[model samples]
Target chain A: MFNQMQLDILKEIGNIGAGNASTALSQLLNKKIEMNVPMVRILSFDEMMELYGSADKKVASIFLQFSGDLTGNMFFVLSVEKASTFIQQLPGLDQCSFVLPPYSEMAISAFQELGNIVASSYLTALSEFLRLSIIPSVPAVSIDMFGAIITYGLIEISKVSDHAIVIDAEIKDPFSKDKNGFIKGHFLLLPDPDSFQKIFSSLGVNQ
Target chain B: MIENGKTIKVGIADMKIAKAPDKLRTAGLGSCVGIILYDLHKKTAGMAHIMLPDSTLARGKTIHMAKYADTAVETLIRKLEEVGVRKVTLRAKIAGGAQMFQTASKSEIMRIGPRNVEAVKKQLEKYRIPIIAEDTGGSNGRTIEFNPENGVLTIRTVNLGIKEI
Candidate 1:
C-alpha cells in the first residue's frame, strides 16, 4: 500500500537512483552530468495506458532496467533524434558520427553503461534507505522496436508480480558535472509500490 | 537572430514571454501550447507556452513560473491589466499543441497538448477573455510570432512531412 509516507520515500529513492544513473552516464560520456528527479506518484494501470502519445520515430530507443530489493521491471524509451541529442551533448563521443549500424554498437555500450550505473545506484540507495541489500540482474541492451522494448520489460516484471510502483523522474543532464551547467537530461525512477512508499516516507512527504 | 527589438524565447509548458513594444518583437513557440494573450486596448502581447497541464503536480516555483494552465492565464491577464489593458478588450489566439512524440502506450504525459488546450480554454472563460482564434492539436510543432499593435499572427511549423493535425 502506497500511503503518504510511501510517496515521500519513493521521491527520495528516485533522487538517489538518478544520481547513480548520472554517475554512470557521465562516465560513459566522459563528462560530468547531473540528474534532476521529478515528483513521483503511483498511477493505475489505466492511467499508464492513456495520456502518453505514440512513438515519434523508430530510429533510436534508450533501454534500461529498474530493479530494487522488492520487484519491478521498467525500460527507458527515447527517439533516435533524442539519442542523437544526448550523444551530441555527451563528451568523448564528440568524434562519433550520427550515422547508423556501425554506431549501433557504440550506442548499445552507452545504454548498457548507463543502465548499470542507474540500476546499481538505485539499489544501493534503496538498500541504504531501507537498510537492506539488493542486486540487479545483468542488463541486456538492444536497438530494435520501442514497443517491443517497453513491452518486454513490462511483461518480464509483470510475470513476477501484478502490483508495481513507478517513479517518473526527470533528470537534468548537465554538460559539466560541476556547477555553472544547464540541465540537459532527464532521469526517471520507476520502483515497485512497496519499496516506493518506504523511500517516499524518508523524504518527509505524504505518499 | 539578433535585432534592435526584444525577443523573448518561450519554452515548452507554462512559460510566458513578454516585452514592451520597443522591447520584444518576436516570441518563439514549439510543440507545447502557446497562448497569445493580447490587450488591444494597451497594445501589449503576452505569450505562455506550457508543457504540463497543471502546477499542482509541480514541486516549486519556476523562473517563468506559469506551470499550470489556470495560473499562467491569470498571470498573463494580471500583467495586461497593469499595462492598462481592459479586461473586455483582451483577446487571445492560441497555437502549438502538437503530439511531437507518440508512443503506442499514449500516456497522459504525452496528451499534454489536448489537456493543455482544454485547460487554457477553461481558464480563458473564467477570465472572460474571448479566444478569437486557435490552432491546436495534431502531431506537428509550431512557431508563432505576434506584434502587439498590428496584432498580426504569423504561424509556422517544422513540416516534418505530414500535415499538422
Candidate 2:
C-alpha cells in the first residue's frame, strides 16, 4: 500500500519518467519540445472522459504506458484535423502523404516508439528511485476514446487494480519555438485497492 | 461559427443537426455518426463522432452529452419525437464509427468502434427507425454533412466505407 511518502516517491518517479519522455520527444521532433510538471489526480472513468471534451477526440490516441510498482499512462490526443495539421506541420517531420498521413504505418510506429521511450523513461526513473527494475507491458496505442480504447484501458487496469492516478501535462517550451509542441502526459501510479486505501489514509494524515 | 460558443463540435464528439441558425450545429464531420430525424416531418439530424460506447465507465473526460453512441442517438430520437417527427419518417441514415483508435486497446480490450456502431444500431431499432443507409466501421474518423435545409445526410469517413449512409 502507498502512503504520503510512497505517493511522493511515485510522483518523483513519474517526474523522472516524463522528463525522460520530453527528452525523447525533443530529440525525435528535433526541437526543444518541453513538458510541464504533470498534474496528478485519481479519477473514475467519467471524470477522465470529461477532460477529453476540451481536446479533440476526432484524432487518434497518442499516449504512453508504464507498469511496475505502479502504472503510468499518458495521452497525446489531437483532433483528426489537428492531428493531420500537426503531422503536416510537424516542423522536422517529413510530409509523406502515404494514403493517410497521420494514420499511416509510419505514424503508428512513430507514436509507439515515442510511447516506448516515454514509458521506459518513467520505468527507468522509478527504478532509479524504487531501486526495482520495472519493465512495462507493450504500449497500447489506439485511435481515439471512441472505440474500446478508453473503456478497455480503464477496465483492464481496474481489473488488476482499484484506482489509477493520472497526470496531465502540456508539452510546450517557453525557451524555444515548437508550435507543434503538443500536450503529452504520464501517470504517477495506479495502485491496488489496498494501495488506494493506504493513499487515502495518507491524504487524510497529510491534510 | 457561434464565436467561442460553449458548443464543442469536434469530430468524433458532439454533433447537433438543426435548420436555420441554431447555436448547436457543426456542418463538417466525418467517421463520426450522422443522425437525422424529422421533428415535424418531426425531423432531426444528430451525429456524434463517438469513439467510445459507454459513459458509465472509462478515464479522462469520457462523458460528453454528444460523445456516447447510446446517449446521442437516443437523445436525438427522443428530442425529435418530442417536437413531433413521427416514428416512420424517423427512418435514419447513420455513418461513422471508425476505428480511429487502433492500438493494443483494440487487441487487448473491446473494440469501441464496432461497439458504438452496434449500440447505435440497437438503439435506433428500439425506436423502429429503419436505417436506410449506413456507412460505418473502419479505421478512419468521419466528416458528416447534414443540410437542415433539406434534411439530407452525407457522411464521409476514410477508405473502408465511403458512401452516404
Candidate 3:
C-alpha cells in the first residue's frame, strides 16, 4: 500500500543505517566490512520466513524492540557458523561454542554486546536522519529457529494483516576468501504498521 | 517426520486437513500456536497455525480465518465436519507459543506466547474438545507434524530434538 516514492525513502533509510552499522562492525572486528544496498519489500508472513532459507533454519538472532516516535523491531541475524566465527574474534572467547546449548555466560554477553554496538549504530543513524526519538530495549540474544525468532517481531503486524513491510540490509566481510564471499549478517527492520505513517510523514512523503 | 505418506503443509496463519495415509505439518512456530483437531476413529486431522488470540484484534478489511485462535478452531471443526468427521469424536493436540525473546518490557505483545496458548485452550474448551497432549510454553521454536494414521503428534525443537506427544 506504499507508493514508489515511499519505498525509495525506506530504502534510503536502510542504506544510511546499514552503512553506519557496517562501520561499527569494522571498528569492533578491526577489519573492513561492506554492506549491500538495502532492499525494501512487502511480503506475506510465509514468504518472510523463507527469506533466510526455511522457517526451521537455525540462526543466531539479536533482537531489540524500539519505542518512541517510531515503534518497531530490529533483528541482527547471523548464520550459526558466521556467529561462531564472530564470537571467536572477541578476546578470551576463542573456545566459545555456539553449536549447542549451555553456552557460556561470557560468550552470550560478548555476542549481546556486539549486537548492541552494531544495532545501536544503525538506530542512531536512523533517528538522526528522521529527527525522531527512538529508544531501543536491551538486546536479547536467541540462538534458535529463524521462523520462531522472527514471528515475535510480527505479532503486532499479524493482528492487522498477514503481510509485512520489511527493510532488509546485508553486511559482509570484504576480504573474505570464501568462494561465495561470506555474508556476515542481515539486519531486518520491521516497522509496525502504524509506524509507517509516522516515517513517511517525517520524510514528507504522502502515502 | 513422516516417512511414507504425503504431508499436508500448513503455513503461518493457515490451516489444512489430512486423512489416513497422509499427515499434517507446520514449521517454525515461535509465538504462534499450532492446533490439531482430529478424530482417532476416522483417521482425519486438521491443523491451524494461528498467530493471534482473537479475531476482534483484526483491523483489516477482511479477516483470515486461520490467523486467530477463536476463529481458527471454529473453522477447523467445520472443515472436519465437512469431511464427514464427527465433532463429538474430535480431540486436540497443540504446540508452540514460546516466548522467543526475554524482554523486561510489560508490553502485551512480548507475552503473546502465553496469551496465544491460553486463547487456544479457551476455544477448544468452548468446543468441548479434550486436549489429549500439548508441548507449549518454552523459549524455543517448534516444528510439529500430526500423523492421522495413528493419531501421533511429533514435535521437533532446536534444543530438545524431537518428541511425540
Residue-by-residue lDDT tens digits, candidate 1, B8-120: 65533334445445222222232346788876556677887654456665543342345457778888888777767767788888876554444343445445567778888
Residue ranges of candidate 1 with Cα displaced over 4 Å: A1-207, B1-4, B11-31, B54-65, B155-165
User: What DockQ results for candidate 2?
Assistant: 0.12
Fnat of each candidate: 0.00, 0.12, 0.85
Best by TM-score: 3
Q: What's candidate 1's i-RMS value?
A: 13.8
TM-score of each: 0.47, 0.60, 0.96
DockQ of each: 0.02, 0.12, 0.81
TM-score, predicted candidate 2 vs. hidden true structure: 0.60
Ten-residue region with minimum lDDT total, candidate 1 chain A: A48-57
Q: State which candidate, 1 or 2, has the greater lDDT.
A: 1
Off by over 4 Å in 3: A175-183, B1-3
Candidate 3 recovers what fraction of true contacts?
0.85
lDDT minimum window of 10 residues, candidate 3 chain B: B1-10
Tens-digit per-residue lDDT, A54-136, candidate 2: 22233355544444544434455443433343344354445623234345766656655665665566557646654544556
What RMSD does each model have against the real structure? 11.7, 7.2, 1.9
